[model samples]
Target: MIDVVVIGGGPAGMSAALVAGRGKKQVILIDEEKPRNAVTHETHAFLTRDGTKPEVFREKGRRDLLKYPTISIKNSKVLSIEKKAEDTFEITTESGDIINAKNIVLATGVTETLPNVKGIENYYGSSIFSCPFCDGWEMKDRPLILIAESVQALHVLKLLKNWTDNLIVTTNGNKIFDTDQKKMLEINNIRLIEERIIELKGIDGELQSIFFESGEKINRSGGFCTTVLDNRLPFIAQLGIKVNEAGFVIADVMGHTNIKGIYAAGEITGPSQLIVSASQGHMAGAGIIADSCEEAFQSIQK
Candidate 1:
């Protein structure tokens, strides 16, 4: 059996496999190569790597891991994971390969559902985005639109103010905000639109304008959205893993889940930056090393 199997090839899984491989343990990092960040043009907030393209960052990360002889990366999707016994798991891949591992690290991240607006996919990660901190600077001081349908969007509007005062927020015909929130937007000079969006006009992934059902057209160079997150995992249901109310896995500081020999890290635990996810993977790898060493020591004592 492999010493460790990491079920995501993102920064967290790769980092965990790297550390474990450096500890002289055999590791397999499996990934489907379909990453959420592939939609974005650039990534931000990682020192020395800020503004780097997502695919470039991933390629560089793979290069670093290639130096370790004990580490292997499998470019395939994991179809299912079955706990065969204590400290043993059988992972079935889409390619019909079954990999057995003594330890498992789940770095599977969450997926975001952009607001249900036509042509939104074209502008996402380009002229429109979800995270402000990631793309706010590039869109600073431009006429921006916020397509949000929830009350929580009020907070996002406040964050956008730091980048531009020329802001317009629309609820897509959903009046989900309280009266106080409406008053707050009015006081801040943020125009609020409560009509349904008819269409988003853009060219070459660049957002040019938004057409509302009320026959109103607003020109916006770039903007942001408050997207819904989906973090559900098939393994969680099969293995009965512990998760918080928000669908995030409940793991310790070292990334140990409630189940023995199973660990979790990265965005599945919570929304985290790239560096933070990598750091969590490192800790989880260290935890695996400690556990393996202790088990070996106990066997030697016997």
Candidate 2:
């Protein structure tokens, strides 16, 4: 049995595997190669990897991780996971292979649900994005739109204000915000348009304008959108791991979930900066090692 099986090979998973291997634990990293940031041209705010392509960072991480003989990576998807016994988990892959590990780390990030508007898909990650901290600098001083269908719209609007003063919030026909929230946005000079977005006008994955169903067109350079994220796998539900209201895994500071022998990090736990997710992975790895050591010591005493 492996010491730890990390699902997902993104930054968080890679970091976890690296740390676990360094801790003298046998590790297996499984990834389907469909990183959430695959469409992003560049990743920002990462110390040395700022402005680096997402794929390039993953390539470097993979190369470095391979240097550890105790860590192995597989290009496959986890189909299911089951508790075989106390302190052990059995995982089944899409290829029908079964693997058992003492602990599991779920770094399976979320997939974004884009606006139903036409042409938005082509511009996602290029001109349209979700995280202001990640892509806001590139779109600074430009006319932007905050496309949201829930209270998250207010949060996105507040953050985008730092990047550009010229901004509009497209409610996309949802009026979920309360009166006070509406007043707060108005007082801040952020226009809220409760119109359904019909389409996006763009050229070759670069957004230019938003066309609303009310015959209104908002010309925008780029903007942020709130996405409805669904967990990539039902593992959280099947394994009875507690999740937040937002459908994210609930874990402690060190990435310990309510379910023993299971941990989670990255976007699966909560929305975080890339560097923050990597740091969380390192902490989770350390926690796993600490827990294992305690278990071993207790067994020896018995």
Candidate 3:
């Protein structure tokens, strides 16, 4: 049986597999190649790898793992994972391959539900973005819009003040803000538009203007948004893993979930950046190694 099976080959999975492999563990990193960051053009704030494209970052990460012979990367979709035994799991892939491993690590990230406005998908990751820290610098000093659909909108509005002063906050027709929040926006000179968005007019994914159902139009260069996020995995309850109130896995500092012999890292565990996910993966990998070694040692004493 393999020592570790890491699901989702983004930064977290790749980094986890690297650590496990370097520790002489037989690690297999499985990926479907659908990364959440696939929409973004460039990744920022990762030391020594800042501004690298998402795909290129993963490619370079894979190349670094080639030095470890025990690490194997597989580009296949996992259909399901079943706990065959107390310390063993059977992972079934869409291609009908079954991988049995002593430990499983879930690095599966969250899935973003963009705003319902028309043409948002085309503009996402280009002229529009979700994370202010990631894409804010490029949009500095430009006229921008902040589109939010939930209570998180208030936090997003406050966080974005660092990037640009000229800002407009819209609720897309939902009155999610309280009196205090509304007052805060007004005090900051941030126009609050509660009108429903009809469409986003742009050229080649570059945002130009926002149209409301009231026939009002606002011209803007680019903007930011905070949309709904959901955990992408379907087997959390089946595997007895605990999720927090935010629908994210409840992993500790070392990425240890409530389930034994199973671990998690990255956005699935909580909010994260590329570098943070990679760091979490490394810690989880180390935790798995330490636990597995203790188990092996105990077996010999029995």
Residue pairs in clash, model 2: none
**TM-scores across all candidates?**
0.97, 0.95, 0.97
Cα RMSD (angstroms) for every candidate in the order listed: 1.3, 1.5, 1.2
Over 1-302, each residue of candidate 1 has an lDDT whose tens digit, in order, gives 99999999888898899988999999999998877688988889888899999999999999999998999999998989899966699999998889999999999888888887988999998899877887889999999999997876987899999999999999999997889888989999999999999999989999999999999999999899988776767887798889998889999988899989899888889887888889999988988999999999999999
Better candidate by TM-score, 1 or 3: 3
Candidate 1: residue 163 lDDT (0-100): 97
Model 3 misplaced regions, further than 4 Å: 300-302
Clash pairs detected, candidate 3: none
Instruction: Show the lowest summed lDDT stretch of 10 residues, model 1.
Output: 228-237
> Which 10 residues in a row give candidate 3 its minimum summed lDDT?
79-88
Clash statistics: count for each candidate: 0, 0, 0
Q: TM-score order of candidates, best first?
A: 3, 1, 2
lDDT at position 43, candidate 1 = 89
How close to the true structure is residue 68 of candidate 3, measured as C-alpha lDDT?
90
Candidate 2 or 1, higher lDDT: 1
